[model samples]
Target: MEFNILNQSPVLNGHSVEQSLGHTTELAKLADRLGYKRYFVSEHHNMENVIGTSPEVLVTHLLNQTKNINVGAGGVMLSHHNPFHVAEQFQLISHLAPGRVNLGVGKAPGGTPLATAALQHELRSDIDSFNDRFLSLKSFVDGTHDNHKVLKISVDTESSKPDLFLLGGSLSSAKFAADNEVNYIFAHFIKNDENLLKEVASAYKELYPGGKFIAALSVLLTETEKEKKAAKEENSVYSLKFKDGRTLRVTTEKQVNDYIKNTDEKIEVEKSQLDMILGTKDEILSKLNELSNSCPIDEFMFHLPTADAALRNLTIETLAPIHTIHKEKAGIL
Candidate 1:
């Protein structure tokens, strides 16, 4: 089974931003030494706890800091930026890393409404929707913008194009990826809809033969039974804290405005679900095998939810030697 680390540059125990970023850099190096396949960080904005606001910038940082290890974005929220621009950014990243950069695009707004508004100025009603924008992004990256050939976008690199992965929680997105001949990641951690995951995996197989289907889940590798229980307890929050730094899933207008008005406002969101692989070595491996049998996914990406620095390092150290996906990937998850 292929294992990858999904990071969000989390700020543990309210550490300074510099420390959090430095810690993330160290983790990237650790992943490189561990033999994990990829180290992909998600893009988030206006969150005190998570410092990763830009994936392209972070990808560049990871590439510079690590010698080997695929470095890429778990996803770039494509809706916020221009498609050509996104393609161009990855173009540089792909050439810099050469066969290690990935451009995973997702439809969901990666931030609150306020943040999205900041990103998306001059909205166009007649412009592109998520599907349209994604198609354009694909075209730009592939250098196949369907217009005058004189105006086609090119990567200006001899290396291969960044492997494009569509991140989603629905079957429609799976079909979109398959139809477009791109990679697909079923983000079960976002929403643990088992039925949807099965359907998407099945649809991907039927839609595109030999396509890559990834199962990305939240995971926490604990050292002891006591640690496992504590990890679960720490993550088992009953309410959402998006308005504050406790969470980052706030998307509604009211919530975003409230957050903007008072960054410390304690707003609550309904139904905060937690789906993770939190257990010992044998248990994690066994659960991974079970998930493999349960779905037709081709790869597995593990997203860590903890901000505890020691625990995080322990998880990586514990899993690195035994659960390394490749002899060397040094790049991304």
Candidate 2:
């Protein structure tokens, strides 16, 4: 019943980017004090709502601010940067917070086509070579690369390597993580199919026993009907599947229309409910327990969907690990 956090640093309702980022920093410190396991920030680009464009910088700041709790990128989209640089960045951060840093990588572009193109303009590798890039990044992080031929990452050898996690929603991604002997996190908030979750978990476990399987879900801890309604209104997402087998998650219809207008590739748009868990603290805990029972989820990472800062803080406080532990000890959970 371990809990972690995935922050998007959304700039909601005309809030300034600095405000959003400041909130993220404070909440991360709160999560650390509450005994949460990890606080991972997402990487998104060219999105007005989300301002978390650089997760490595955020991870570094969070690591410096918090006394305990692992901090990292929920994922660094691998298609936009050089793998060697990515490995070197995280490896250096690991020295700052040894045994408390994570490096989760994903294949998604994490932005619109224009931003993706801009980011990758200088890189030699493309999205098609994501597998090879991920392997090379892993080798560099683990110090398994040939130092005689390739430049080493050159970090403190005594510092622990950042715990690697592969972030994806597909069974293929699950197999890929298992095959590589890395941890896997299913993006349940993006695509909440119960059967698919079970199948992916089973497949990963069958291939790599004892590997960590985490489910990242959208959650909203609501205290009133108005709050619940507002959260749901903001919770909806659209999954755009391109003809070339790429999928993009966008929040607004305007984004969908913009993508269609910008790209020449054909796409199929599917509006998703996002499967947000909206309820009181007790109800949310009950649903979480039920979900964990149904699947092989070793940990639950929450992606709070509300834009209201007050509601976000309340939700974090309500479900903090310390509160859960206290309730369990008192036999009231």
- lDDT per residue for candidate 1 within 98-158, as digits (tens), equals 8888788877666665776777777685767788889888888887776626654452634
Q: All candidates' TM-scores?
A: 0.86, 0.94
Separate clash counts for every candidate: 13, 0
Which residue ranges in model 1 land beyond 4 Å of their true spot? 155-158, 223-225, 236-269, 321-333
Candidate 2 lDDT by residue in tens digits, 1-333: 689999989995657889889999999999999988989999998886899999999999999999989998989998887888898899889888889999999888788877877887876543547788899888888777877245777636445788999999899989999999999999988877878988998899889988999989888788789977877777788999977577889999988888787778888999967788889998999988898888778889999887788888888899998889546757886
Worst 10 residues of 2 by lDDT: 148-157
Model 2 off-target regions past 4 Å? 125-128, 148-150, 325-333
**Model 1 TM-score (2 dp):** 0.86
Q: Choose the strongest candidate by lDDT.
A: 2
Task: Report lDDT (CA) for all predictions.
Answer: 0.77, 0.86
Instruction: Report model 2's TM-score to 2 decimal places.
Output: 0.94
lDDT of 2: 0.86
